[model samples]
Target: RGLKFVIRKVTGRCELQRICHNNKPGARRTLKIGRPTYCLRIILCQSALSAHPDRVEKTIDDIMTLKKVNPDTNPQLGISLQASLFQIVGYRSLVAEVEKLRREPYDCENPDHEEMLMKLWKTLRPDSPLTGRISKQWCEIGFQGNDPKTDFRGMGLLGLHNLLYFAEHDKATALQVLHDSLQPKHSKMSKAEWEQKNFDKAIGYSFAIVGINITDLAYSLLVSGALKTHLYNVAPEMPSLSHFQQTFCYLMQEFHRFWIEEDPCDIMEFNRVRSKFHRRVLRQLKNPDMALCPHFAASDLHLVNL
Candidate 1:
């Protein structure tokens, strides 16, 4: 009327046996479960556990849940639940870090942030001088008006951080993308004609504005966990903000090319093109082995025609 059970741990698996009182020999039945080797280490090495014991426990629980969800599916070919949990936790921590920046409104009063902004502009332009706090030069780079601060209202310091990171990391590529956004080439029009028409047609879209918008898009993708697919495949361990910034750079360049290729009639079609591009990104992320990085091929940017 009573049952006893024993659990045994092995290198790559765990075994559970249910012992029953029966007259027949070999009455014990064993269930072999595929357990990640790390789980056993965590259980045995109490001194080596993380400082946050509760988080470690939660991670173990998540691992159990993951095993339940994908009983037979091994997405990473021997990838353990503990490893995946670490990546997930790292991703969430990064999200929290970025969200903090997003929530923090840009304070013009803060001299450091203000200096960083000017430094970003200088890095992007190089030759052009920072005339003053507000100038037409700001518009040349794609701000809506003479002032750039107003545009960062939505994304806050997060937007500036992304923009500055891209510019500082790869100034040449960032400048090229900015120029391309400003004056996209068309198949029929000459360079002069295209430059003339670019202003009239692309009213609301500009390099700086579009870059900030793409930052928001990238942030949303991270928050929704769609980026986990790519992160898990590319980064075996925890991913950093640099990974996200790299992704933003790719989006900035790719969206510039996509916008030109689509040749929308006006800025009104911005939403339509943006939605289509979002779907494309989601589709790519849906692939189990999709790996995307900041450094992409010229073909990847759709620059073959150019």
Candidate 2:
């Protein structure tokens, strides 16, 4: 039987090691006979040569063509093809780092965690649109409180969302806690509506904190977590900049509801926040003169005098 191998870097060590074989599908195995051409890594290495999707298929065809013309000379050519098909690659190095962090006894409150987090953030400086390193890091380590957010602020909305997804996957409780922290007090509105509102608000403030940057990834992560998991249900796809802004506004509304119920600080002071683009804040209140009851809206009903 042809042998297969999976090379993984040991956690935190930056050195490659082989995982054991247990007859698991695609498990790494050592061969006593000839060298098997197949090797896999948890993450794919960044390929320097750009292969077009069509060209990759064509290249395989060309290789097969060559093998056919000289079968006697190409015993290993087939092996190479088998290896290429089974191989996997990318940021497994970061995954190892995250796993190492988890096993270590370092205190999160210790100053070293912050240093490690910042270093990890730096390691994820991707020039490409999708950041696989960052994604794998979170998947491996899960959430380490708000430090990931604080350390990763410059990464913008998409970065936050990616982290949030990882947090949710590994630390659902923590993500909920953060959402609760940001949520506004008291609400007579629907929870789904409130979740939407809170997300909208969070997005809005995050923009001031993040500016014009890639945010859809972040927004998608949050929406999937908060809404999909029934923390609150709202739209999943925040496709455009305008949708993100709208979601931000909606999130703010929800946050305000939480804030009212929690009564953490003066409501007036929260509104005084510098708006994204410094736009004036609009207040929604119910008029007693209208058919709605006074308690229905949290804001003052001047209709008591009317």
Candidate 3:
């Protein structure tokens, strides 16, 4: 009986000490009443300002999250903020920033979110020259050996290859880069080692980028109306250009049905007789092998993304 009573007294003493240690509720109340509240308000104001600033309706919060990747901050948190930026602003703006950064130098210490900036910029201004600039930026970033996720500024070997799909008519530099990246490199390393270390990732990004860029270029051409007028208004005296007209006609027919209300498809289909050229394009480009035209592979991304 004596031992049990002593045990109960000790247990009761420990429980009381634990309660004292848990002064959390009182401490929290004190914070709510004083300077802690003011500090919290300041933090909230900063966070809100970071979220929406200067009425550009084009906030950098998404890219700023990339800054959170600093050791003092959080990577996952940064990614989440990026995800929001991507959803709200689109990848084109990020692409745009990368392109612009290529035209200028970005501090290595700041290593800005040039990719996201480029992507977002392109999103807002589809016709901006910044699109091609991004591809060049990728090359610059790659030459500097930055991480793929953080510093992919769009002018790397892959960036060059991707940019060419859209740049077939305008970007000579992109074409040259594409040619250089694909040339076989003779190294002491085995093929497997080369692929593991470099080739596979480069090749994959190259293929995807090529396809995406092409689609964007094609969409711009077809949707912009000038390409269609150039094709349809060909001088009848020039029989040699008929084949080109036929190719444009065919592409119009194939995609026009899909985009009935869009300027690209609608303008081309306005005259049914003008549509005869459309049939010829399908015959020229489509094959049983399901092989994509160099143009098709690149331009299709515009369809899915836009």
lDDT of each: 0.64, 0.30, 0.31
Show pairs that collide, candidate 1.
Answer: none
**What residue runs in model 3 are displaced by over 4 Å at the alpha carbon?**
1-190, 195-197, 200-205, 233-306
Tens digits of lDDT, candidate 3, 69-166: 24234333333333232222221232333344334433324434445445433432345354353244343212222232333333332233233223
Candidate number achieving the greatest TM-score relative to the actual structure:
1
Backbone clash tally (model 3)? 41
**Backbone clashes under 3 angstroms, per model:** 0, 32, 41
lDDT per residue for candidate 1 within 1-306, as digits (tens), equals: 011112222223222111111111110110011122455445424422442536645655554454343434533322343444455556667788889988888788899889878988888888989889878778767778887888899998989998998888877788877766666434565677665544543323677888889999999998997887666555545567777777788888778778878878778788899998999889877654565556543212221111
Model 1: residue 26 alpha-carbon error in angstroms: 41
Model 2 CA deviation exceeding 4 Å by range:
1-48, 62-158, 167-173, 176-306
RMSD of each: 10.6, 22.1, 24.9
- Lowest summed-lDDT stretch of 10 residues in model 3? 297-306
Indicate which candidate wins on lDDT: 1
Evaluation by lDDT, superior candidate among 2 and 3: 3
- State the number of backbone clashes in model 1: 0
Alpha carbon lDDT of residue 150, candidate 2? 43
